[model samples]
Target: MPVKTENAEQLSRADREARGKDAQAVAPLESNAEFTPGPSRDPVGLLLEQEKTRVPELLPVRHGRMLVSPFTFYRGAALPMAADLATTPTSGLRVQLCGDAHLSNFGAFASPARRLVFDVNDFDETLPGPFEWDVKRLAASLAVAGRENGFTAKARRKIILAGAESYRTAMRAFAEQPFLAVWYAHLDVEDAIAQFRSQMKKKRVKATEKMVAKAHTEDSTKALRKLTTQANGQRRIISDPPLIEPVEQLFPDVRVDAIYKLLREVLGKYQRTLQSDRKHLLEQFTLVQVARKVVGVGSVGTRCWIALMDAGDGTEPLFLQPKEAQASALAAYCGRSPYASHGERVVAGQLLMQAESDIFLGWTHVTGPDGVDRDYYVRQLKDWKFSFPIEQMIPSGMAAYAQMCGWSLARAHARSGDRITLASYLGGSDQFAQAIADFAETYADQNDRDYAAFQAAAKDGRVQTTTDI
Candidate 1:
């Protein structure tokens, strides 16, 4: 089927509803075909190919992290999964997709309003794609995670269904609201806690409150205290080796002065991407140190650097992370991003899909020491951000968390997609939810197979890994 590119504003709400109903003729709501690896394609090869675009030395660390579990491998295998999702059935409605919208990708972060808000926190793989693609990926993640956690199949199915249902119901609610209202709708931490308290037992609610309190303390000041130290009357980033090492330590042959100059130039360019007020706020701090920090499974091999800055009086500290951005995993299937710079692409997508964003979010392009031009987006190192403890998740708790993830994702799509049409397509039924449940189960099986293949490759010396990066 040809992709649907019609703008939501081109049709009346009723007309959009009719258009959505037309979609069922192409693909039924409950039809979930199993994932079969393409006859000529190799999942392992696809993974190894992505490594070519990353810092070569860190590739082993990336593999090591992914080797931990099938769930972690899933996190790093967005490209392989995107290739498969392109072959699956879609609802034909596009959105600013969190292209790797797994359960862990949704988390709590402090918004510009200084309120802790819950939403999709990662955007490295973000792009425009069918809304169902995100929903399916999220559902499948829950299934994989449930298996890893040893939940019964029946219990996993319930969680998937609950998540799908939450998305459908939330989309329906957003569809009824005015466009501006839908654009502004957000779930702050306090609001999240209240909703959970009403539905959750006392024990879970207390645990949640404690988690929220901890997240609040994870701001820039806290990070500064933990990751920096005074060296010759200057605060410098403490090298923890492999995980958090100074750039000079990793690249001893390279001139440190040249790297610092290039970074300063890149930071200046990035400042122009921000709003006038944010740019002014940033000017108060001067850069003191920069360190390459390996972060996340999928992003482990990427050149992620943390820069520390301080006010002239040494009273205020600011931490900014300038992480490399590459072509989104979705770009190959959907289309090249409209923005020239991939960093700009990431920043633009985040601003569009998120109700509120980090005040310092911006992008820049730089030529690295390797002579390769790279794109990077910069933002505060930590702004009271934290994710829930998935290890402690019970079936019932997962069900609740899944619902929140679904609701959050739906709200994000509603802002950048046609919620009215999505609502009409879903149409107050369980068919779509059931379809997602089916897809989740099947995809979870596929993940297991892929993980086994990866493990075998590692054992045979086809892949390399270390205990810690």
Candidate 2:
């Protein structure tokens, strides 16, 4: 896809029209008339733009080689993939897309109602896009994951089919439900456990029970131990050389004291982004300690800080993550988003998609010593968030988990998009589902090729990777 000036102008007009149509269709639905799409930049150009903005200390020497393989390509190509999808055929129905809705992105978390729930957690690539894009990405991920887990080709196909079918069936059911009921529907941990027990019979259910039991027992101490290590006398993030460099190693130019001061200032601004009631509630929490943590394959080099705050006493520690924000991968292709602040855009999108969100959700702008404006959003890092490990899931278990993800994604979409119009567009057919399933299989192959290319590049010294611990 080329960055057509004409496409940019057309997108702006379409966005305004969409917002107007949305407002007229429903009063409660928020009108985003001012939300202009970014320039119609092609996928590779968008990826290059993102690569240019990455923290210099975090950049791999073989960044070019990393882009040569399909798998490495997938990781770095999120912005481009999103841009390409924007130009593809669609029903013209929009939703609160998870932007990067791969199988790994869906996870468990505690709901506002104090119940453990599982849903989509990562939203870095989130934006308003055709609803099917998320579904396709998710289904393709299931296929890739299934193959990695040693599932037969036929079995992988079943997984993809089941995943897509579940989404189609769930969306239709949700569309028929009353608005309030649909908005409030969510699967709590207990509900999930009950469902699992019924499906797996006594023996299998007992096995699953052990996993859940272990998960429930996981506390801050265990999480801290897993994510941190003892360095000299004080605890610090474990540095596994290039793959997991400590903050000090990555930013050698900045003193530790300066980092701490800047962090405190950033935290204060994050608190202010909360609603008055939430801010009042946050006042009771005191900062206990902070550590630099590296997480996720795609986000490895980005600045991610974890702060441990004491809520009441030593027993109750809240983990908050102040993650770095980049411009939406969809922004350039879609045209610059109307929102001035990317952090605000993320917060708004999360609030719109989630049934309830962390009370402390907010963002702030911080200029690093390097003179680059760094955008960040802060929220409770881990408040009873959990997920079934994809590698450990059996075919039946994977199917069940995929259905849950589909149901949740549909609910999120229905909440943000014009459901009536969307339902009408989908009608009573499986055509869309089949189309996406086919697309997912093809894309999964593309991803495998990309991953292989990345590995080969690394082996050939074209890409630099630190595999050994």
Candidate 3:
């Protein structure tokens, strides 16, 4: 799957550009305009297989969440789409992929500099793969979301074209720059607001600004206020049943003290993975309480824990989310990851793909309550993380958001893959964008059919779902 031109040292700039152009003859740009499911395709079966490694109780919760809508299903259906993408045409220009590069996966987060920067925020399924695979996933996500929002076909197509074209044009521009320039490029959230504010109505502009303001307040202090309560004079995470269960609730038979003791030891080891400065900073904070948390739809069944840490003074708090990392969905279709730990694989991919990353980003191995060894990556629970409520978004707003995602993705790909090669392959036209739009509509139709089949399976009890969770 990675049989593309990856070694820049072996090829001249002209030769790399020629290689990209020559790929068009092998797999024409327009060849991406169709979607045909293989006869053996069983979306439900694929989903079930993926859920096997997850916690049994949370399986129902995952299915229930995915059962919400086609768009919601698509959000948690990265594995199925990875299977589909493996069958698609490619130009063989490989890059570090946000293998689950759906619309909801792109957003703004606090950079190391404390500035809000937009980037591909989720990388649980990140791996090296054909660059267009991420592009198509992003485009198709917009189509799915548009349909859910009641956008007409013409509107959805226009949004998809805008996004795909943005990627092409951005890549072309990056191809002309020096390596450091491409590496340093980032979309500042404030700049993004400025760029799109004029295109929106006055009311919409105010709402957007309000959203940005809200993100700034979504840090550990906010989590401390919202998710914790005074329990026996200690600030402990509230037990919100399946959504947020204290570790004591999760393993009643096991001693809660013993679990915390082990976790503290694990964190002691995990801190070693960080830089000396970060490790020193972490030493100031002491692990306080931990809760088993249910996160995103696809990751619901995976082991996720919200760890509460206090800086001894008990005035300042730090919340970290330790999410279990499994083998990427692309690993089966592509080759197995070079890294021994899936957690490291995810962190490696994120560092390569994002212009700025969390300062506390690190990985560690943990033995679960069930006695199973699993890899996990840890990051701030929330640090000015930003996500849009696209349900209220209009078509023009979506078009603007799409361009931002496209440009950010291109920047990421340019840093890891060959910018010159991709620029040459995409050329100075919208032919590829048109093809992506065509494929988006076609694949979105397939997603609709699969979503319906999943609904039927749920009705027949082929899959159990507990929406109350």
Top TM-score prediction, candidate number? 3
Q: What is each predicted model's overall lDDT from 0 to 1?
A: 0.87, 0.66, 0.91
lDDT per residue as tens, model 3, 7-121: 7747898998898899898779999786789999999999999988998988999999999999999999999999998998888878989999998999989988988889999
Top candidate, metric lDDT: 3
Per-residue lDDT over 1-469 for candidate 2, one digit per residue giving the tens place of the 0 to 100 score: 1111223223443453454355335422212111123465444334335666655545563254344434335645566556546555555566777788777778777667766677778888777766767876787778777877788777777777677767767776775787798788776756776876666657767766676666565555666677665566554556665444555665778897787687678778888888898888877877655655656656656677778766764555667788887777766555564567777777777777777676668888888767788888787776666667787777877877787787778888877775555554444666555666666667667566556655665578655554322
Ranking of all candidate structures by their TM-score, best first: 3, 1, 2
lDDT string, candidate 1, 1-469, tens digits: 1123476777887898887798776667875444566777577888988888887878889899889999999999899899999888777788899899999998999988789999998999888888888998999999999998999999999999999999999999998999999988988877877976777778988989988899989987898889988888777889987889887787789888987887789899999999999999999889888999999999998999999888875558889999999999888898888888999888988888788899999999999787899999998889989998787898988998999999999999988888888888888888899988999999988898899898898888888877565
Clash pairs, candidate 1, are none
Candidate 2, residue 57: CA error in Å?
4.6
RMSD of 2: 7.5
| Model 2: worst 10 consecutive residues (lDDT sum) | 27-36
Off by over 4 Å in 1: 1-5
TM-score per model over all chains: 0.97, 0.81, 0.98
